[model samples]
Structures are given as structure tokens and as C-alpha cells.
Target: MKKMMITALSVVMAFSLAACGTKSAPDSAAPQTGGATPAPDKKEVTLKVGATAAPHAEILNSIKAKLKEQGVNLEVKEFTDYVQPNVQVFEKQLDANFFQHTPYLEQFNKDKSMNLVTVTGVHIEPFGGYSQKIKKIDELKDGATVAIPSDPSNGGRALALLEKNNLIKLKEGVGVKGTVRDVLENKKNLKFKELEAAMLPRTLGEVDLALINTNYALEAKLVPTKDALFIESNDSPYVNILVSRPDNKDSEAMQKLAKALTSEDVKKFIDEKYKGAVVPAFK
Candidate 1:
């Protein structure tokens, strides 16, 4: 009976110890505190984007601090000409670019056989006709020299603006696709000078008149609302976009940028800073 009692006591102790071990194991393994699990640290990412000097770069600069707070470092590279931005982006030298409109981008993609895509439409820089010598469109003399962008899309845009004001008439239905050859009627016998878009503002005094992009006009200290002889309507179809490759278009960082570019803050900045020269495309 004594041996049986000792054996029973030993068995009871073993079970108690086993139970204790099991209880403590879970206690050490899992936190019993009612706190939520901590989130993993956000990995900071760097995004390199290219843009023109005025509104594009300026607008991009406006959101740099905001993006940094969101764990993205935005590097804005300013390009003087339109071609390099697209070239660099295509070659993977830049993650994206922010200076061209939809027509321009589509034409560029078609012409170069590139597959660049738009991430978001940010704003519109109204195409305008400006001249240092003429205060009014009627003041343009016969045989006056008019400057327009050399690129096909912008050249067509300039021609459309002139045609709207009855400065010239395009071949029927040619619309914004018309070139110098498509001029059905030249009332003033105006000579068309096909210069680069960037050079149009500089040729304001040299050419009898020049059609300039608002961004370039702003860079040359000309306000589109005040200085332009004729400007595109607010509902202009050419909304500038954030262009990127297909591979990175849907990336977390790129989406964040697209969101930032279309945010209310950007709209406010565009309204307050540009007055009417640069209009935000977003609602």
C-alpha cells in the first residue's frame, strides 16, 4: 500500500509539471497583451521624373515634401526640350515624364513605335498666339511671318488656333491634324515659320507673330491670359499627362505619384499660382 501511494504521488507530480510546462510554453511563445500587431516599416522608394521648367517642374516641386512624408523621394529633372524627356524615359534613364499632352504622347508612341502609357492627366497649358509687335489679331500685316512649333502635333495645334480666329482656313475636316500645306486659304499671305516649340517664345520679336505653349510663355515671363493674342478654350482636349512605361505604370510608387499629381492640393496650386495660364485637369 505504501509503494502504491508513492507511485501515485510521483504520477500526480509528473502531470502537474507537464501541465505547467505546456502553459508556460504558450505564454513565452505568444504575447498575451491585448495590443495589435505592429506593422512592418514602409520601405522608402525613389522616383525620378522629368518635366519642363515652369508648371511641370514647379508643380512637381510643390508635392516633393508631401511625397517624402509618404516614404517616396521624388527627383524632378528639368528638360528644356520635349524630345529628351521621352527618350530618357524610354531608355529607363527616367522612371516617368510629365510635360506632354495626350495628342503629343499618342503621336510620339505611334511615330517611335514606343508603348509609353499615361498614368494620369495632371493639367493643361493652353496653346496661345503671342506677338510682340501686334496688340490685336487684326493688326497682322499682309505677308506677315508667323512662327509655330515644328513638331507635327503642336504645329497642327497652332494652325487650328489661327484658323479659329479666321487668320487662316484649313482644308475641310483637317482640324488639328492640318499642317502648313493644309492651309486652304491664306488671307494675309502669311509666311509660316516652323520653329521648335521652345524657340517660339524667343522669336516673339523676330517673327511677326508666334504661337507659344503656356508653359514656355510663362518661362519667358509672358502670361497667357494677359499676353496671348489668342488662347485655347478651357475645355481644350490636350490634357498633359504623367507618362510611364507599362512595366512600372501600376507600381505602388508610380500610383502614389499619380494620386499626388491629381490631388486637391495640386489643383489649388495650379489655380493660385498660374491664375489661368495653367489649368488643373482634375476635378
Candidate 2:
């Protein structure tokens, strides 16, 4: 009876030791729910904008840090041609674009049947005429080839500039709306070559004179203030603008970008960097 009792006691002790030897699950293995819940981090908004290489991208790059501080990350995509920027914005691939003026935007909207509105006016890249073949405007010979932007608005702008310089005369009151067909008087009997705005800079040697936008001229290393045979006045009506769809035009991020673009810092940067090549449209 004593041996049986001892055997029972031994059995109970062995069971206890076996249980202890089998390690239990760790506390870390359980899902924690009792402690305070951690707050989620605020997400940063990304604002993608398309721009021309020179002043547009350069200007946008200047204010990146300021936009970032406001929880908006600015991504500037550089474009060589004018059409894709507007196309990308209209297709919702980009948040906005900053290369064209109000007139061009209006014409683009009308032509494409797309409604991209201007957020704010940033600066005026005065349209100018450049030539590698001539040193002066008067040096352009009769029947000289003059290359201009193919688009209606800019073609008109270039024609108007030519008219303003007395190289040609458009129909009365045609003004900036005139096309090559409106040239009523051609004192030089100049031939008109309409090319893409981006290509004009490269055609300097090919054409007697290529009317180039300031942005392209700058990209090609041509200094507008010094190199342009003739340039539009600073008060010209063409003001390059920030453009977006009506839906997102007034968003917080877009507004912040617009504000930063027209800020005093940007004004100073334009003044010091572009000299008289680019003029700030904002007061």
C-alpha cells in the first residue's frame, strides 16, 4: 500500500515536470489590443506639373521646398513640345502645366474642345524673332524665309510682331489674330515657313529669321535680351499661366503652388536671373 501511494505521488510529480518542460506560447505571440492605438501618419500629397525646359521648369524647381513644407510634393515634368503638356493635364495624367499663356490656352481649349482653365498668371516670356543669318532686322533680304510657329495663336503673335516691326503688314484690325494669309503687304516679299514653336530655334541657320518663343530660345542658349533681333514689349498681353482643370483648380495644393509661384521670392529670382529676358506679370 505504501509503495502504491509512493508510485501515485511519483506519477503526479512527473506529470507536473513534463508540463513545465513543454514551453508555453510567448506573450508576444498574442495580438495586442489593450494598449493605446497608434495614430496613423498623415499622407503627403503629390502635385505633378508639366513645364517647358527653361524658365518654366527652373521656376517650378525654385519653389519645391516651400511646397513640400506645406505637405505638397511638387513634381515638375519637362517637355520640349507644347501639345503634350496640355494633353497630359486634360487626360488627368498631370495635375497642371505652366508653359503657355492665357491666349494660347484659350485657343487650345477652343480647338481641342477641352476646358483647361488658368490658375494664375506667372510671367510673360515675350515672343521674339531670332536669326543666325542676319545681324539686324533690316538685313533680312527680299524673299527671305521667315519661320514662325504653326499654331494659330502663336502664328498670329509672330505675324503681329513682324507687323509691329514693319517687316510686313496685316489686314487692318487683324492684330494678334492675323495669320499668314492676312499679310496684305509684304515689303520684303518674305516667304513664311510655319513650324512648331519648339523647332524654330533649330531652324535659325535654315531660315533667314525664326520667330522663337523666349523659352525655346533660352533652352538653345540664345539670350533673348541680347540676341533677339526684335522682342515684344514687357506690357505685351501674353502672360504665361498655371493651368488646370476647373475641378482641381482651387485645390489646396494647386493654390499653394500658385501662391508660391507669384511670391516675392519668385519675383526676385526672375528679376535677378532672367534680367530683362523674362518679365514677371504679377505686381
Candidate 3:
């Protein structure tokens, strides 16, 4: 019995010595490039995702499973507001973000001189017109008050959408970014008021027609396919993007995420899910 007890103690001490100060395989939940090695069969990505709570996060949810198949462990982080996500990305707290379009992203970079770039276009959310007071565009009376996003980019978006619906006409080469001042013609004789993008949807009842951004409009229970009087074109270059630091624009995990979000499966998902409210921009 004394010999057996001594042998058991020897085995336990050997195991303890092996574990002390000995690092196991690298965490499969994060990247370890200094002294640690990647796990043999798994790739770890402490990828941070910054996005809106609904569709952006909802879209990410659909791709999480597909991304995992490529051995990338993604952490999809949700942001309720728009500005913080970009700041988080610039601060190196996030791996990639998906919430804004090319024009907005360009504006963000130009405004802050941050080095953010899009990996790929994921979805195009249409800028739309909606109203509870008026049933449809044709129902809008002459001299009716219309509210639109006051910001440059989205105000231009609203104008383009208005132009597309033949409610207004723009000067040649005015482009989709044209504003209320750029309206070479306004046939409907409607009055225009510029309000912040986030406020337009909530002010719907006060105006005959209100141009609400897709995301906010959706939050207000407005469905582009049914509720919107008009929606932007499907290929709206303003399509929201999946973005990362310029340095990791082509990283393996980033590539996997970009591809997964734009994959055929996702395309079908958006088509069937948003019902034309959200258009998959990638062909």
C-alpha cells in the first residue's frame, strides 16, 4: 500500500510539472501571432463586427454559420446608432463594420481622415417615401408639405428617388446626388422641408409625404415593398458595404466574411427575406 501511494504521487507530480508554465495550443477564439501558434485545425479570428441592430445584424446572423465553416470565429457586435460603429472601427476595437453605404463611408473618411475601406458591397437599402396621412404619391396634393433628410448625401438620395418617380426633374448631369436646389424642375408643386435623416420617419404624420431612410423607415414599421410610395433603384451605388481597416482589406477571415455575406445563399435570403426592401447588390 505504501509503494502504491508513492507511485500515485509521482504520477500526479509529473502531470502538474507538465502543465506549469506550459502554454497549450493558441486560442481558437482569437489571433495569436507573437509567440503563440494557430490551432492545428482551426483559425481564430477575434473579428469585431459593428452594425445596426436589425438587418445588418440580422444579415450577419445568417452568415455566421457559413463563416464558421471556413474556420473563422466571428463576433458579431451590434450598434444601435450609426456614428459609434465607425469610431469603434477606427479605434481598432472592431475588425469590420457593416452599416453605411459607399458615399457615407467616403464622407466619414474625408471628415475624420480615417483609413477605412469597403471590402465589398453587401446590400442596397432603398430610400423611400411614406405617409400615414396620404395613401400614395398620386394622392399628394399641390402645395403639400414634404419632409426629406437634411443631410447632403441622403437628401440627395431623396431627391433622386423623387426624380425617379417623376415627381421632380433634375438638371442634366445633376446625378443622383442632386439636392432640392438642384431640381431643375418640380412638376408636382409640392413644398420641401429638410429634416435630419433619423427624424424623417417619426415626422411622417405631420407631412403629406416624407422621405425616410430604409433602416429607420423599417424601424417605424414602414415596409418599402408595401408602405413606401417609391423606393430607390436596386443598384443604388449607395449600397451599404462591409468594411475593414485598409490593412486587413484582403485578410483571409475578412475575405471569408465578405464572400459569405455576398454568397448565393445570402443573395437568396435577402431577396426572399426583405422582399425588395433590401436588395442584394452583388451579382
lDDT tens string, model 3, 237-257? 788899889888899889988
Q: Please give, for residues 151-245, the per-residue lDDT of candidate 2 as tens digits.
A: 99999999999999999999999899999999999989999999999999889889999999999999999999999999999999999999999
The residue pairs in collision within model 2 are none
RMSD of each: 7.0, 4.5, 8.6
For all candidates in order, the CA lDDT equals 0.94, 0.94, 0.83
Expressed as tens digits, the lDDT of each residue in 1-283 for candidate 1 is 9999999999999999999999889757897546677779989999999999998999999999999999999999999999999999999999999999999998999999899999999998889999989899999999999999999999999999999999999999999999999998998999999998998888987999999988899999998999898899999999999999999999999999999999999999999999989999989
Q: Lowest-lDDT window of 10 residues in candidate 3?
A: 21-30
Model 2, residue 221: what's the lDDT? 94
Against the true structure, candidate 1 reaches a TM-score of 0.87
